[model samples]
Target: MTAFAEERRADRAADAEQRRIDAAAVDARRIEREKAADERASRLNEQRQTDRVRAREAQARTRAERRAARGEALTPGNVYRKGTLALVTASALGSLPAQVLHFVGISPMLLPLPLAIEGAAWVMAAGVAYADERHLPGWVRWFLRLLVLAAAGFAASINYTYGLHLPGLSAPDRQAAGIGLAAVTLLGPVLFEIRQWVTTLSADTNSPEERARRRHERKRRRQHRSIAQLADRFVSAAPFGQLDFEEAFAHAWEIETGTSTPGMTPRLHQRAARSTAALAQAQRSAVGDSTGRGLFGRLFRRQTESSPIQNPNQDESPQSITNRLGSDLQESAPETPPAGTEPPTPESADPAPAVAPEPVAGPVAEVEPVKSAEPPVLRPVAAVESGPRRATGRVPQSARTPRPTRTPDELLTEARSATADWPDEKLTAEAIRKAVRTSSANGRLLRDALKAERAERAVSEAQAA
Candidate 1:
């Protein structure tokens, strides 16, 4: 029984050993599976990391592309600004040749003035490049441009004249250099203007649509500039920016030509200025006329109003009435005696009585009865049966012709007034007689007129002396 038990224990021990071996194998397999699983997990994590890296790289590439597109989009505006800078730089550089010649003693006499001019030109160029020309006065900008061009030409000419014979250069090289410099100098103004124009057109026009709009605007500006130049030549020189371009130019054209063009008319400001001037002139003329009338009217009123006070004690006789009316308006007739009384001797008759007194040719002088307390008779002159008519035939009273009446002093006044505008040389007695009558004139009236003329001449001479 003890031996059987030991064999059994040995068998059990073997069994236990076999079982341990199987367990160990199982453990080893489990370890191997865990190792394989860890390796697969690590491989999968690596693949995920690679995918993330690829995604990041793709995103970075897209960002780079987007940045490149935006840069391209912004390039035009920057380039335009750079072009302006370049033009200004070139203008400044145009002074180099003359400066070089001066430094080398080739153009010593032509140095200082040209150097100063070029320096000023450079400063102007820089200002013009950065500023908007539309804001500047046309004449000012034009003058500055001309100055710069002149400076460039002067510099180029000096270089050509003095620096052409530089020691190391061949004839061909010298000629080529001279020609090139001359060409650049002559074209300096044009090149600068074109460059400035390009800069202005390209500035702020980044997209194609904006550029197209700018081009259209430039075309319109060109048309307006041409019209403005024409208007300036014909009319007054109104600078740009001081007025509206199209309207100002149109008004100027109308004013200069004295007629309007087909599609253009004058502006409101131009019309307003003219209207204001005319209105002012009219007002001045009205004021002057009113002042003159008031002055003359006041003088006449004072004269008429004071006449009664001066002659209050004098009787109102026919002679006095004649004198008063003659002094007032210089139109009174000479006083005559009544029909029954003999005619008064003429106040202005000549002393010589060789010629018989002739009848006056103007209005008949008649005695005008004065207004008195007594009523006067109004009877026709009964023909004392005048001599000639009764002796010729037993003519009826109605058929008898009355004697010719003498002219009054009132007709002499009319004659004087009629000849007022006549020249002094044309105011002879014969001319006055001819103007007064187509036929013969009265000798008595002529003699009176002659006396009056002599008196007037004496008075004028005394005053002049």
Candidate 2:
């Protein structure tokens, strides 16, 4: 019975060992499969990235090709201009050859007189071409001028240097004279032909319509003298015209060139006046004085009184009374209700205290007590001496008198006020505002006047419609 028991135990142990090996083999296979899948994914991702890079490179190449083609098409005109410049440069350089020949005492026949002459003529022709005058065809004009000047210079230089045989007729002198005269005769017809060619080129270059248009423009400009004179007169007036003078002149120039100059002066003046009046009114309102008396007085007073007040307890270094007062007032104020809440009715509103409460001592003092349980209600009480209510709805007599109301006529008056001093081209909004404010008796009055004027304008516009 002991031997049978040992065999059974051995078999069971062997089976358990086999199961453990099988589990490890399965785990290894699963790991290998996962690694293969990851490798495949990496390869696919790399392929996609490569494809995108290739596409971008191809697109860039296409754009480069298009730009290259465009550059090629424009190259001819650029090359022509360059060639013209080169002609001038070459002519200047030719002088060096002539100077070298003279220094070397070369044969009169080899003298670079023609080359030197040609160079100077080319330079002059280049200048003429650059001017782009209307009478000549650009290329032909440049070529003819350069050629003629060069030929003339060549003939003159040769005649001066070696051609003339005056007191002594040396063999070299006779030869140079013959050569120079021959050159002049041969070149004269060439110059004449070039001139004729240039004239013909200019004629052929201009279309009949273009010639007609130019003629018409010239005629129109001549006829427009009166208008031009009028505009100039207006611009020169003492107060610069409210119109932008430069812009108006430019418009006039365009008109003389057969373009229309839109009539804008009346509209410009009307706009200027309106804006000026509006600005004046705003300034007056900001000053808080309608009567214009002591208008800016408060500003000066506030600035002068801004210094710190003397403290009773200098050793203790008393806290800023102003800051403390502000903080205390803020702390003592009741919290405002949410935005949607209905405001309290006049009858239900809590009245504000006439005076602030004194601060209490101790730790509780740090925690400010609310001065009023309810929001303070502002009551419009009539002053003992009744006066006009300001635009701000405050009684003027209580503190400052309200600014006076602007009349319609005062607002309209700004429209006709001399803008002749203003630069024709630069009618600034600020200038207009200043003019309007000064025109009105008071800012508030100016504002009212402007509003009434605008309303009238609207009514008029509607009636016209």
Candidate 3:
């Protein structure tokens, strides 16, 4: 009975464990579904906001396009004209009362005289703009301008007379009032006339760049009046659709300059070519400088010791040019072989052999051979630097990583071990450097150590004998 009870408890525990896992899985799936729904809601809200913003932008674009088609959009010129009109109106009102009173002193019928005077001046100012719009003769615009000035002058005189005799004013006050009235009367007409001039000239409509271009064009026409006239004639003669003003002018310019291109003569082209060649030659000399001081030295290189051979690319004044001889960047001659590489002759082992001259383009060097049983150790000459490519710009065969530095003793030990089996005559410093992959200085030192050892042994053998 106890065993059965324990088994039943175990079964119950297993069922509870399975139920807990199933509940956890169901809760996890519910959480995942809620997260996905929230994400969808957030994305839908963002898309709605985006669509609203785009709709607003599209509406604004449509409004702008409509305004453009009607040509009634607000402009800076409209604002300027409106502001100027307000000022002119205020000036007129300020000065017109005194002028009307001055004219009224004569007769009541003269009341309209001041208005007529003021209105006529403005009419003439407007007429100047009208003349420009109608493309009228220059004389017509000038006539209207003269009338505007005459009307403004008459109005100013009337205002001055009225202010001088103003009622309830002291002498000084009356004089100031008269001056103020006269100034206002004159300013109203002048302001109006200036505004008309601005409109007529279309000065405010043109951008600064457009104005500058027009100024340049006017100057060019003045400088080349014949070209301008010919261009104008050609433009007038050309068929309407076949040629444009600029194209016709271009043809006329070519004909007038007697060249296919405008503003270029054969002499000018030749001069340009020469200048380009000189510049290129200067570049070659600059890059050819082997010394790291190409920054300034090559540019300011003195003409001293400069070659006389005039490079076709060089300027005629050879004194001012920088030239480098032996700039062909030839490969450096093979490194001079060491003394151990010397061949064995029938004569004494240490006889000084005549050194063969290294092939070079410049001056040759000669070494005199000496005849002695035990000749002095001949120091091998360093390779000639006539090749310029030693330091000049040459494409290297391999990356120039510096070898690990070792001490003199370490270098000697390595060389001795590597070349011990080699014959004495074949044990050259160049050979040791290649065999051990060491520097020239270390190889030379090792070769000398071996030679000294050989000399000491020969002496010891003689003592033994």
Candidate 4:
């Protein structure tokens, strides 16, 4: 029995050992699964971080591109910055003399005088720099610079006079100080002129090539000015709904030569083509006569016609011929033939009545000559009687009188009048010449322009009268 019990105990121990091994295996599996889950989570977090970094980088790139597109990218060198520095320095230097004078003065303070002088100097310096860059004549530059310096000296004198309380010393002291400063300011410009003269006289003076280059530049400038002037005139003269190519070319020619020319350039041809296209577009927008009539008849008809209906039915045409006729009769009957002229009798009048003319029909219609009871009497019309008598076959005096030709002075005056408001610095004879030369290719266009201008002037005069 003891052996059996010992065996049973051993069996139980074995069972317990088996159970412990199973628990250890299950725990190991759970630990392995938890470690794998942690690694996966860490990898996911790392991927998210990477995506965020990429997005931020993309945003930065986009921002940089936008700034570059707007031309706001930072650049190191700038002319305005240099000019500002120079202006500041000049202002400081200019105030030195005024400051010295102010310290010597008693009673009233002279802050305004020094400030004014400094401000004037700075302004003058800026002007000088601008003028120099603009290629103003050296003599003009020097003159302007001296004027600025003189102004500064005058301000200093005023400070002394007012602040020092020495009214007697004001005029004389001012004059003396002004004279001294003027002399000093004049020194630089005078010396510069002398140096230029000496250089011009020296063996190393500007070469012939340089001189030729300068002349060419001047010519180019003149041409550009002429072209701009011509363009301006054309723009001004052009009808609101019509492009004036002929006028443009004429003005261009005048700019090219101080007078009218016979031709136009390739550029002018292009301009004319563009203008014609624009005019066509404008004309499309203009409400043409319903009958599609031309200038003389259509204009007269429009002036005479009255409004038909304010919101006519859709079924009704926008324009009605009967309505137009009624309007015309009302407006134009007063200007028609006098009632004293009797209506033609059936026997005297042609059997056929005048009808609406066909587009292809010639002006003179073939009509049968009617046999009259009384012989035809020769009678003078009012137009013939009122005007000076001319030979039966001769041209009228109005047609024979020569039109006045445009003089250079007249052309120049016209150009000046057109550009009167433009700054002198902006105006250039070269530009004018260029514009004229460019339009010299088309002679007919120039002639047409002149005719149009003359017609317009005549119309304007008549209206004024």
Candidate 4 — worst ten consecutive residues by lDDT sum? 326-335
Q: Rate the local accuracy (lDDT) of all candidates.
A: 0.54, 0.49, 0.66, 0.48
TM-scores for every candidate against the unseen true structure: 0.35, 0.30, 0.40, 0.28
lDDT of 3 by residue, 1-465 (tens): 999999999999999999999999999999999999999999999999999999999999999899885564357677668778888999989988887887888888999999999999889988888888888999999999999999989999888988898889999999998899889988877877787787766854568888888888888789878878888888778777776766776777788776778677667766666665555445444332322223222222232125334221121122211122133223332234344454335565643335532334443234444443343343434335545422323223221211355544455567667877888899787897787765454455456556554444443454443
Cα lDDT over the full model 4? 0.48
Pick the lDDT winner: 3
Where does model 1 exceed 4 Å of error?
A: 2-98, 106-119, 168-173, 184-192, 202-465
Worst 10 residues of 2 by lDDT: 310-319
Give per-residue lDDT, candidate 1, residue 187: 58
Cα RMSD for candidates in order: 29.9, 27.9, 26.3, 28.9
Candidate 2 per-residue lDDT, tens place, 1-465, comes to: 899999999999999999999999999999999999999999999999999999999999999999998797559655544554454345344333434444345557755554555545544544454444445566766676657566655544644454444347887777765564545433533444444456455655569887888777567558666666655765776375576655555666555445454444445546756766566546545433333223333432343356334211111112332223322322222344445556566466755445545532212212222334345532333233233322222211222212455433443355325343555344443344456644212233333333333444443454443
What's the ranking of the predictions by lDDT, best on top? 3, 1, 2, 4
Clashing pairs in 3: none
* TM-score-superior candidate, 2 or 4: 2
Tens-digit lDDT string for candidate 4 (1-465): 999999999999999999999999999999999999999999999999999999999999998899885554233323334443454455355445545565546435664655566566546655665665566888876776786667655655554444444345666675665554444433433333333344334423358877777687567547666665666677777777475644675667676755564456545655666665455435433323321222223332343354333211111222432233222222110122333455446777434434432222112222333344433332222231233322322222222222345433343334435544645454444443343331121122222223333344443454443
Error of 4 at 84 (Å): 4.6
TM-score for predicted model 4 compared with the true structure: 0.28
In angstroms, the error of model 4 at 166 is: 21
